[model samples]
Target: MSMGTKQAALDGVGRCSRSRPQRQSGVALLATLILVLALTLILGNIFYRHQIDVSQATGSLHGDQAMLLAISAESWARDLLASDNDDPEVDHFGEDWAQAIPLLPVDGGTIVGCLVDLESRVNINNFSSYTDTSLRAERSANANNMGLVKLWENLLQNMGFVVDESRVSVIVDWLDKGDELIGPAGAEQSDYSGFNPPRFPANTYIADTAELAAMAGYSLAEVQRLMPLMSALPGPTTININSAPEPVLMALSGDLGIDFVDMVLDNRPFLTLQEFYQAIDIRLMVGEPALAIRWPAKLIDVKSDFFQLNLEVTLGQSRLEVKSIMQRGESGRPAVIRREITVVPAGVTTVPSRSIDTDDENAADFSGSGRDRFSDPDEYDREYYLRPICEIADSYTTGDLDDSGEQF
Candidate 1:
């Protein structure tokens, strides 16, 4: 109650208030730190799970894209080997094949493909057939190798490209020569060059134009120009005049006393080659025209009723690799048997080739426009066959398919 007692009580009350507030502040600070740590742990877990989900989804998409493209490739190949028609010439798209992402209507999916040509495709079985001098030599020499080369060369030359001749010769040597030698520029694996990869001595026989990249001096550009004009077919020497070109015919006339290059070019797709041959400038060259000169049947004008295809496809977050071999039976009906190798973890797979159903006739939804290829009898057939099928494709092929005529 006294003045001194009142002052002391006020001081004690002030001290008590300060101590209680300080204690509360310390507890609040500790709670805030713990809350921050808990929030950080939760956010980290959520982000990590989200990242895993994104990765899985990405892989799945890639796998699907790869597969669809593969199927597309097989269809293109079958169309290639369907029929030897003069029309719808496979000049563009190189060999009636396409790659990269393409949209399919059914599944509304995108796919990348590598369409292959089974006819132009080399048979690993015939790898060494070029080396058989006796079996293939006489025929090779007798046929119009000159015209064939010229047509192929002209295709490249006209396209404004210059090729390495010596290196090309090495390719020919590799394909035809029986004996093997260390190819030109034989170096260790580390020293080869072509892209970032060191590629040397392409010893393996080429089964298709795609393999041309493996050959020395044969750039992708050069091969692209030559692909439509050539095939990795039965090594019968001559090229069919029906499918041969003016440049090739000119070369033929230069070599043999057949000045029919212009005639052949001027009027091609003749019903019979003999009709075109009759128009040759027989009197232009003074030498005796060898009437009995029987040419070997090195080249045969043919259309394969059956064809096979190999497809490599890639789709977004998914992958499907198909080694599909479509057999174009009689009437050019395709019977596709796919060897599918899929790479999607959870995507649904549909393999339609194994079954025979009305709806499944084209379950793959493959396309067909026009087709052509090479054909040779297992044994040498003396019968000379030179005739092209009816022109079926309106946009891509030509009726006159030649620079050299297959004269045997």
Candidate 2:
């Protein structure tokens, strides 16, 4: 072979080797870019999850702090009510404890709340007397036993609900410790089983007004509407005429017309039951004498024993609401009978200023634990024989009429 031809072949082989190396370098560069992209995506996902976990943990911590603040506020309320017992014979909106706890800045946020007189509203548990079969039969035989039932009927009418005796019967059946129906509208486990997701009747005194709405013939809206005027106290309690809403005062007796209610409302914060009676004597005299005679004197008083403390605590990102029921006996020291707490959502605001709501039992989140002290009121020897101030004046002692130990 010629030397020139051999040199040409060697040059061609060198060019081919150089081109192969360039192609391999390009592939390696692409692979390195792909690896970096995959790692970046993985790290980004991890960082995002960590941020979410941190946020959730922070929220939980804030909620715990808010709850503690709310509990502390509850203790403060108990003491306030205890001190107010110096004049336990009278509890009215004009009193110090009735005033609201204004929004006060705390460590992390703010706290606000107010006290409610539970006695100012009708107690649904008053009808639990129907649970006793013998008593039920006896009450059924007497028109006087039907006084509370009639009052409830009137309240329903005032609240725009259709007045049905069955409505009251159903509520009684829910509270009665019997499987037998109280009336045509009464409900039992059998009736409850017909629901989509079956529910059973409580068959005992309810701790929450939500239970009242759960019964047949009652709606959530109706219960909410009545929330301002009704309570599910541990037992039967008299209405505090001093603080009762106009609707409640009107419900006390069918004869208590709006004009009569106005008289009670305008001159109220009555210092004594006698004072309340005097304020309405003029109207009572003018009304039908028979109806005036039946003025439900037994169902009312000027003082109260049951009160509710509603507190709202806000800490950082968390807002908590608490409701506590307190029972103040003759000793005058208030004891918590029930408590409930709820976590409110962000971006929602409730009236921070204090206002009166009949009972906290109306809240859907009624998860509280406490023992209730209950004493059934004495049954009247004569059902409709309720008397006013003049009749009781001769027998009424100065302190005998205090609500803590009141007989009627």
Candidate 3:
């Protein structure tokens, strides 16, 4: 009776053990499937994000490539200038000043270039020195306030100050004199009473062309009118006649005639003293033989062996710009002396406005197409050179107040 009862209990115990083990194995398989699915979903999300980042990175790289191409166009144009020897006007593939350089594989937009006379605008940086008769006369007999510089002087002069006593001279004095000293009875920190960047000698030249608006005599309206036509560059006081407009050429004269203005305008430039003098002698009047003109060119405004090129580019989501300035060096007649690149916010620029005269009063303003985006060297102030110099002028110091090296 004891043996039979023990056998039945042992069989029941074995069955219970086998069933428990099978249920545990099934639960383990379910957990494994869920774990695998979770890992697959996590990996898919990571892969999707990685693809987005890669796409963004590729687009950015393309934009950089486009910007580089835009910069290359500028270099190519500068090289053309260096090789030109004596030819002016950029004798291009076409007669247009802003000749398109053509879009290529990496380039995102069209690029074009033009040369403007560095000397055409009044050198606002020298306002202090121009005021100083003793200082300015040494530069040239023609150095007396005239042309675009005189236009500005006349503007201020018309407002109040005596021609010689005008604030323009004070500004000239500040720029021309390396030593920061207010002339006798002139404005200086000692005379400023309490102003910053004193009206009198501040012992420094202008660091920024925008600083001119802060000077005592200039009105915002007047400055705005005159500013577009002038610059504060290393070259003070002189605007390159070769690069000047007909309006500037007419203003340069003490007394001007229609024929004279036309004559000067007909010609592209008069940089060399002989070239200017000759151009003047050849009278535009019908009755006059090539008689001598009244004024002699005393000063020469040079663009120097340097130039600045503006480049803008867009590629995919990347957008950039470059303010590149290049220098002529010791290697040869016009070898590359230095090169600098300045990047600024995209879409910001100082593009010039344009207008065209017509017999019809109702003429449309179709000249939007005529706007010039390339900033003429004259459009800058002498102080404007500091930025390029800071970036490009090696063997020089940011400490310099004026750049006499590029004087015209």
Candidate 4:
């Protein structure tokens, strides 16, 4: 009986030991599974953050590359202007400097650039009354002082935009030192104070054309239309006959018509004032009554000193646009007066092509003969003011230089 009892007790103790070990193993396995799952979650979060950081860094790099490309294009434009300085007699669309840059392939991107003559357009600052006695005297003496206002009116009308005479007067008031209101079209501090967010008239000269939008009554659409035909240069500058658009040419004188503008453009890049006069005489002999009036030689010139360069660059998924105003010095080298940079979305395919079709029905009928001359030109050909950069490159490669220092 003692032996049987001892054996049963030993068996019971063995069973208890085995059962405890099995329970301990199950607990250890559950803990291990929980630890593994926690570690996986932590690692996954870290990996996701790392991927995000890498993507942002790549995008930043692309943006930097795009900016550099735009800056490089501006430099190239300066060089082109410098080259034109050698023969400063004329600035015309036919010249190499007026050519637009085509899409050029670069490292991880493409670039497009173009140069526009600021002097070709009317200077808004021409109305400003500066402390310079010489400038003041010129403003009073030159008939073009009023002529500029007329020119702006003509340009707006030609573009199918209703000219706001009051707005125009306000611009004139802004320029003149005197506080006297310019008839019904002018504005002063009183007019601006009436706004909910009270604003004041800029009594001084404007630096940017966009500032015109801030005027009391001007619309954004109207300002945008005027931007291409107007500039805000520091001082009074003569319009470059060679580069001036047909509308601007007509605005030079109310007597000047579309036919006269076409004649001037057809025989462009006039080497001297005498040459321009000779052309006018020829038009006069042909019974063009508009040509009978004396051209305002003092208010116009054959060359330009100020130009604007627009550059667009794409790098990977990033795009950048740069606009720079360059002023040509006596040495012919252009100095950057202003520069603006903007970032656009990646993969934007709005890069302007080599040739832009004038299919837009809204385009202004430049010819004022009450007919859409742009559709079909009989006597006057509306020439392309901006040529493709590829064409200019080809001209250079082929050494196709004409008497006017331009490629045909």
Candidate 5:
């Protein structure tokens, strides 16, 4: 009994020891599997975050590159304008500056730029009494005001805007220093106060063409239509005949019909005012006696001093646009007066090819043209520059005085 019992007990103890080790081995295998899964999840999270960081970094780099390219393009344009001949008189599409810069390849990007003569368009600020100090003392017949009014009326009519003549008076009244109403159609501070928002008339030179939308009776669409044909500079400026649009040319005189306008535009780059006059037949213009009576040679010139440069740069999926206002100084070098930048999303084209043929029947048709002449303020970059209305008015107020005591 003692021998059998001892042998059985020893065998049971050995089996129990071996079975315990097997159970421990199974537990170890399970723990190893859990550790491997946890490591895989952590590594996956880190990889995903790394990928996001890389993508963000890439986008930022592209944006910086696009902006740099745009700045470079603007500098190039300024240089080109500075290098122009000393003749401050003639700005024409035929000039090298008017030509669009070809798509130039840069470090992982492409850039294009073009220059436009701001003086080619009628300056609405010319109507501001603040620009004419004489109007501040007393309201009287002003030749400059009269000429600008006539041109504004003509431009509105030609653009298919059938506005009342009184609308022009209202705009002038808003600009004139006198609080007195200009005419039956004129508006003053009281009229603007009646608006839902109670907007006050500027009573000063307009800082931007967009300010025209604030006119009491005009719609935003109507104001926008006029934007392409008008500008609001610090002072009165003569129209550049070489760069003037056909509508502006026609507005110069009623007798200058579409044919005459087309003729002048077709034969552009007129070296001098005499060359421009010699090219046109004055006899045809006589058909409208008013044209012969009010030949606007004084209101027009062959050259331009203010210009706008539009540049676009594309780098990878990023796009940027820059608009710059340049004024030629006495030193013959153009100085940048204003600059604005815009960032566009991927796959969007910001710069369009320059169109030299103003005669294209569809050229002035802004509807469905797929081009936006007005740059949205929201799209402007952090460095956007806009002259304040007070600053512009002050500039005119301090300018040289003419014999009539008006600011020149």
Candidate 6:
């Protein structure tokens, strides 16, 4: 070996040492990158969970606010109805209480509500008072039953639904407190046994009109079509002629054609039952004898006892809908009989401007024209507060107010 060979060996050793450090540095960099990735994943998961919790808390807060606002609106409606005792004999669209609560902005979002006369629609529960079976039997024997049956038939035909008298019989059997079938067309427990989920007829008043879909021979679609014109009140309720829709007015008698309904609506807000009868005679050119045979006075009235308040409240991302039924008596404050609250998707709604188009030939159309009676929000809000003291005084007799110390 010579000196040149030794030098070559030294160079090889240097190259080896340099390559070892480069490999180690590469491994260390890989480890550091792996550690960073792991920390990032863990932190991301924690942040995501925190975000979800915050969203849930915010939603809950909004929901609570919406509920409270709905309750306040319901109280307002009850008070409005109670204060309407000044003209307790009539409930017309022209009345202050009948006005819709025009959209009003609130602290967090907005709220809108309206009062509807439930008596304007036919009451399916009117068939049976949900009392003793004997009373139901007695009512069935009365002229009102026949009149109601006729009205139901007329309404179905007008709405383009298949008129099946058997369906009416089934409803009758369902409402009656008796186990006996109404007729061969009626459904009893035996008829319902074949249903997908076997059930029996609720032999009592229905809390909601949706129950009508469960009856035999009726479909959900048919019930939906009839829902706008019908109600399932707690007991027998007369149809309010002052606020009844044109369809209901047309259903009142076979003799009442579209022209007659238009005339009746044109001369609206009948002050008394006698005034309504007089309008009928004047429009039909027929005497009370013909009217008596077709229409039953007991089944109709100018006043309403049951009113429904439909309110919508919004708070942040939450939207809530509330419906409350109030029963107004001849005296004292109106009481809330039923209440329903639901959470819906968040969104905004636009309230259409209301104006009575009297120049239009169809101005007497009840559905559209009647809605036009609601004034602006400012006007609607001021109505209750600005009511005359004399009107409040009229709510009670002088002797009663003197004794109760409730006089204004």
lDDT of 4 by residue, 250-279 (tens): 666455455666677678778876677678
The ten-residue window of minimal lDDT in model 5 covers: 365-374
In the range 1-408, model 5's lDDT, one tens digit per residue, is 799999999999999998999999999999999999999999999999999999889889999878877777777777777746445666776667867678799878888666777888888877664333433322344332325666777667666666675657667877778677766777788777766556677888877887776676665556654555678777778888777765576666454455566567567778876666656645444333343234456577788888888777788878777778888888788888888878777775423332343323322432221113233444334221223222322233223422222222
Which runs of model 1 end up more than 4 angstroms from their true locations?
1-18, 21-23, 26-30, 33-41, 44-48, 51-55, 58-62, 65-104, 110-168, 176-202, 207-297, 305-408
lDDT string, candidate 6, 35-71, tens digits: 9999999999999999999999999999998898888
The sequence of per-residue lDDT tens digits that candidate 3 reaches over residues 1-408 is 699999999999999999998999999999999999999999999999999999878876866676667656665656655644534422221233224343344534443333333344455654544444554453354543343345555434432323554355446544554544435424444434354433444445553455555444443334433443455554334445554443444445444433555565565444454555566566533221222223323333423444445454556555455544444445433433333444444454433322232312211211111112113344334221112221222111111212211101
For candidate 2, the lDDT comes to 0.69
TM-scores for all predictions: 0.47, 0.74, 0.55, 0.74, 0.71, 0.74
On TM-score, the stronger of 5 and 6 is: 6
Span of 10 residues, lowest total lDDT, candidate 1: 386-395
For residues 57-149, write the lDDT of model 2, one tens digit per residue: 999999988888888888888887785544788878787777778889988799977788888888888878864454445446434322666
lDDT value, residue 26 of candidate 5: 99
lDDT of 2 at 47: 100
Model 6, CA-based lDDT: 0.70
lDDT of 4 at 16: 99
> Model 2 misses residue 359 by how many Å?
22
Model 2, TM vs. native? 0.74
lDDT of 3 at 366: 13
Strongest candidate by lDDT: 6
Cα error, residue 225 of model 3, in Å, equals: 3.8
RMSD of model 2 against the true structure: 12.6
Better of 2 and 6 by lDDT: 6
What is the lDDT, from 0 to 100, of the residue 175 in candidate 5? Answer: 78
